[model samples]
Target: MHTPTIGDSVDVLDTPSMVVDVSIMDQNIAKMMKRFEDTRKHVRPHLKTVKSPLLAQRLLNAGARGCCVAKVSEAEVMAAAGITDLLITTEIIGTVKIGRLIDLVMKYPTVKVVVDSIYGANELNLAMQQFAPGMKLQVLVEINVGQNRTGIAPGSEAVGLAKHVGGLKHLRLVGVQGYEGHLQHLAKDERVRLCRTAMEKLSATVQQIKDEGLTLDIVTTGGTGTCEICAEFDCVTEVQPGSFVFMDAAYRNAIGTTYGNALSILSTVISRPATDRAVIDAGLKSLSNDSGNAEPKAYSSMRYRPAGDEHGILEWHDLDLRLDIGTRLELIPSHIDTTVNLFDVYYGIRNGIIEAIWPVSARGKVQ
Candidate 1:
C-alpha cells in the first residue's frame, strides 16, 4: 500500500494512456468484497467489463468465487491465467463458437455455460458428442427476467427447455441464470423492487423445474447496481457483478456510492491556444461518450468539450489558468466497459510510479 506524496515526480508517458491507481483499485476490490463477506450468496463477478486477466486475478484474490465472461475467447484467456472456474453468461449464439467452447472445456475442464434455447443446447450437444463418454457440459437455463434481450420465458416453456437440454446426451441443466440488467441503474427503491420481481419470476421457474423431479444447484443474477438487493433474495445463490470493481461516472451518479474510482485515463494537455479554453490529446476514440456527459472535473466551471478526433477542449470562461503545455490531467471515463476496450494495456501505478502493466487480454474477443 503506497501513498503518493505531493510533488512526486511521476512521468506521464503518453498523451492518452489508460492508467489505474493500484492503491485505489485495491480499495475498490476490498469494499465490494466486504459487501459479500457475511452473505451466503457467492460473488461470481463478470469479467466482461474489465476484460483483463490481471484484473480477474485481483478479483479472485479479493474473494470472487470465479469469473463470468461474455465470450468463449474471454474465458480462454482467463483459463490460461489459471482461473479454472468460469461461467459464460451470455447467449452463445453460433455453431462455430461451440468448437471453441469444446476446446476451452478440454483445456480448463471446470467450465460451465449458460444457454436459453433448445437450439443452442442442441448445438452444444452436437459439439460434445465427440468427447469422452459421460463427460457432460453443465448448462444453465437463462430465463427472460424482464430484460427481453435474451433467455426463454419463465414458466412451463422455460422448464420444458431445461428438461430438453437436460435430457440431451452430452448436456446437463445444472442451474438457472437471469440478469436483471434493465433495473440495475434505476433509483434504489425501484431497482430493488423491480429486480426482486424479475428474480421472483426466475425463482418460480426454478421451482417448476424442481417440481418435475429435477435438481437445480445454482441460481445466479444481479450486477453492481443491485448487488445488495440481489444478495438478499433467498433464491439467488450467487451474484455476478463486474463494474463494482472499477466503477465509472455513470454508475457513481446513479447509485451515489463511495467505491473508490479505480480506472482513469491520464492525458496530457497539448494546446492552450486561447485564454478560456485548453485542448487535450484524448478525444472520442479514446473515451466513450455514450453516457452523454463529459468527464467530471474537480473544478465545477471547467467543462470538457469535444473539439476533434484527437483533442478534448476544456471550456473555462473565467479563470486566467496557467497550465503548461506538458501538464497531465486525469479524465474520468463516461463508460468503463467500452472505454477499457479502447486501450491495449492498463498501467498499474502505485505511489505515482508504474508498478505493473497488464494487457487487456479480451479486448477484441467479441465472438
Candidate 2:
C-alpha cells in the first residue's frame, strides 16, 4: 500500500522493494505475442508470476487469448477483477474446493479447470448440479507429458478421462493440457527434441479423443522455455508462458538472454563487513532463493549469498570498486514467480522515474 507518486526517483523509494521496468516489460509482452501472431496458436500468459490484474489486462490488450492461474482462489480474484476468461491449470479436489470451483463457474461462465481423474470430474459435476444447477463448467484433461506431476498418462489414460468428462452433464471437456515442465529448462536443442516427443504423445492423444467422437476446442501447453517450438506444433492451440515478462537468472540460463530483466529488488548496502564483503538489507524475506541466489545487476565480480532472514552477504573477487555504505544495488531474482510473492506492490519505473504503483492483488491467494 506504500506507493510512490509518479515521477519520484527510484532512489527515493524504500529499500528491499520490488521495481519493474515498464518499458522493458512491455517489450517482452509484445515480443512474445508477436511470436505467435502468424500461427494458429495464441499466447495465454499465466498470472502465477505477475499476480496483478492490471498487468493481466495489459497482456490481454496486447493480444493474449486469456489468462491462466494455478489455483481456484487465483481464478476467483481474476474473475472478480473482471477477467472473464480464465483457466485454473491445477486440478481441484475435495468438497470445499469443488464448491468454490462451482461458485467461480457461476460467476464467470468462461472459467475452466483441469481434471486428471474421473473421480474429480464426478465430484465437480455433482457440486455444480447441487450448488449452481444448469451451469456447465469447462474442463480440460491434464496429460502427464514428461512432467510427473499432476496429470494422467498421454495415450489411453488421457482418452479415458476425457471420455469420463464428456459423459458428465455439468462438465464440458473443452481441451487437454500437456505441460512439459521437466524439459522447460533444458538447452534449446535438447528442449526441442524432448518437447517434440511429448507433443507427439499429446497430439496422438488428441487424435484418439477425436476418434472417440469428442471435439477438443483447445490443446493448451508449453512454457517460456519451449514456447517457440510448441507454437510451431500443429496440434498445440495455445502457449502459456509466464516468466518471459520478468526474466530471471535461472530462466535466462536455460532460454538464453533474449528478454530484458524487468524485475529487480532495490536494496541499500547496510553494512560493510569486510574489504571483500558487504551486506544488503534484503534477504530471504525480500527475494526468493528457491532457484538460486539473486544476482547483483552489472556487478559481474560480486556474488550474492543469503545470510539470514533479513540479511544477504555479497562477496567480491578482484573488484576495484568498493560498495560503500548507502550504495543502492539492484538484485535480479533467481525465480520470478516466488520472488514476486514476497512483495506486495511493484514500483513501475520508466526512465529512472516511478510511473505507477501496481499492487500484487492476487498475492497469497494460494488456496
Candidate 3:
C-alpha cells in the first residue's frame, strides 16, 4: 500500500487507518485546558490516552503544567522529545523498572511517581542512593479513595506512608494521587456525590500529612468525567483528564459530547455477505470493545460487532441503505485509550485532507 502524505485526502488512506479530525482534536485540547485557565488548578493531561510525543507536546503548548504517563517507559519517550515534567501515576517496583526510572529521573528531576507502600518507597529510595546518590525523587502517596486499586489506605495509613516518604533522604513527599477512576463513567449525579466522598478521604490525608509538617506541593486527581467538579474543590491543585482529547463512544454516551469525538478508525467494507449485513476490515485489533461495541460514525441504525481479529460485521437495524463492497466508513471507538494503542500512527485530518502524520511514539511503552 502506498503511504499517505500531507495534503492527501483522507480517502487515500488504507482500511483500518486510525485518523484524528485535527480541528476537532485541537478544539478538544483547547476546551479542556481552558476550563482550568481561571482556576487555581492546572491541567496535566494524562498521556496514557494519546500515547504520542507529538500529541503530548500539543497539550504542553496549550498551557498544561505537565503531563502524566502510566509507566516509566512512556516518560522516557516523552522526555526524549524535550517534555521532562511528568508524573508516573502507577507504582514502580522491581529492580529493572526502578533502575530504568532512576536513570530517567536522574536526568529529568521533574519526573514524579506514586508509591503505595513503604516497601516500594524504600526500594526506590535505596536504588536512588546507590545510583543517583544525594538526589531525592519527588513522590506521591497513592491514596485509596474508593477506587480500591493500587493505593495506600486513606486517613491514618496514608498519613503514615506520607510521613515515611518525607523522612527518607532520597524521597520527597510532594503530593497525593487518589484517582476516582471507578466514577469516571458513572451517572453524573452519583459521580458527583461519590467524588465528594473520595475527595474528603484524600483531603483528610493531605491535612494529616500537613499536620506532620510534610510537603504536599501537588494534590492531583481527576478524569474527564469528573474534572469539572474536582476543579472546584480547594484540595485539588491539578486535574489529569486525557480522554477528553479524543473522546470515545463510551465517553460520549456518558458525558453527552462535552468534548467532541476527535478520533475514528477508517475502514473499508470488504464483503457484503447479506442484505442487511456487511463486513469491514476493522475488528478487535482495530477498535476495542471492552467498554462496548464501537459505533459507526453515521448511519444511526448501523451496529458493529467484531467477527474476528481483523474483521467486523456491520448490521443495520433498519435496512434503509445498502453498503457496497468498496464503501468506506469511520468507526468511533468505544474506549479511546486501548484503541489508540492499536494504531502505529494517527493521520491527522482537517476538512478531509491529511494535515499531519504523528507517530504513536510510546505505543508499546507499557513498562
Candidate 4:
C-alpha cells in the first residue's frame, strides 16, 4: 500500500524497479520529432511500447497527431483516458471483441481500427449494425507491406479490400496501415533500402485505393527504426514509431543511439559468490529475453544471464568492478515492449530524483 510520491529521490525505490530518465526520454521524443519535421507526415507513436495513457497524452502534447494501439483492449484503456484519437493496429474479430469494440465506439466515436480480411471487416460491420444502428465505424485496410504478419497483400488485394469495406453500410474505409516491422532492426543501409521498397509498395497501394475513388485519407505506417524513411515516402500520412521514446538495446544496436536509452530495470547485487561473477535480483520475469538478454548499463563488458525468474548472473571477463552484495545496477532491456509489460509502474526520474510514477494502464490489454 506504499505510494511512490514525486520529489522523492529515485534511490528510495526498491531494486528491480522499472525506471525512466525523463530528461533523456524528452530528448528522444524531441529528436524523433525533429527527424519528421521536414517530411510530409505526422507522428502517431504506437502505444504498445509505453502502454501508459499518461505517456500517450505526453506524446500528443509533444506534437503527435494521435496514437496507435495493437489491440482493441488497449484501445479501450486509451479511449477511457480521453485518448479517443486511436487507431487499433490489429484486426478485431470474434463476437466478444466486436461487442467490446461496439461498446467502445458508442462512447468515443473517433476510435479507428484496421482490418486485414473481409471477414473481419464484415464481422465488425455486422456488429456495428446490430449494436449501434446507423453508425459507421472508421477502419483502415491493413496491407502486408513486408511484415507478413496481419495484413492483406499490398497491390490489388489491398484495393479490393478497401472497395469491399466501402460497400459496408456500417464500416467506413479511412486509410491503410503497413508496418515495416522486419526492417526496424536491420542495419542502416539494409533497413533504408528495404524500407523504401516496402513504402513504395504501400504508397502505390494507397494511390491505387485513391485512384479507385475510395476514401483513403490516411496511410499510417512505420516503426522507430524506419519512421524517418517512412515519413520521407510519398502518400505516407503518418508514422507510428513506438520504441523511440524509450530506446532499448535491440533498437540501439540496429539504429545506433539516435535516441538515448531512457529506461532501465534497477537491480541489487544479492551475492558476490566469485571474483568474476555476481548475482543480481532481476531475471526473465523482470526483463524480456525474446530479442536478447538485457545489458548491464554500466557493466557493458559483463555478460548477463538470467539464473531463474528472480535472479541474474553477471560475469566479468574484461572489466573489473568493485562488486559486493547489495550493489545496485540498472539494466537496459533488449526489448522494451515486453519488459515494460512486466512492471506495473514506471518511476520517472530527473537528476536522480523521482518526478513521476506512471501506471502501465494498458499493460495486459493484449486482446
- Segments in model 4 whose C-alpha atoms lie over 4 Å from true places: 1-3
**Candidate 3 wrong stretches, greater than 4 Å:** none
- Model 2 scores a C-alpha lDDT of 0.91
Question: What CA RMSD would you report for each candidate?
Answer: 3.3, 1.2, 0.9, 1.2
Which pairs clash in the backbone of model 3? none
lDDT leader: 3
**lDDT order of candidates, top first:** 3, 4, 2, 1
**C-alpha local distance difference test of each model:** 0.82, 0.91, 0.92, 0.91
lDDT at position 337, candidate 3: 95
Model 4: per-residue Cα lDDT over 50-102, one tens digit each: 99999999998888998999999999999999899999888888999899999
Cα lDDT, model 3, residue 37: 88
TM-score for candidate 3, please give it.
0.99
Candidate 1 off by > 4 Å = 1-9, 131-134
Question: What is candidate 3's lDDT per residue for 171-206, written digit by digit as tens?
Answer: 988899989999998888999999998888888888
61-98 per-residue lDDT for model 2 (tens digits): 99999999999999888899988799899999999888
TM-score of each: 0.93, 0.98, 0.99, 0.98
Better of 3 and 4 by lDDT: 3
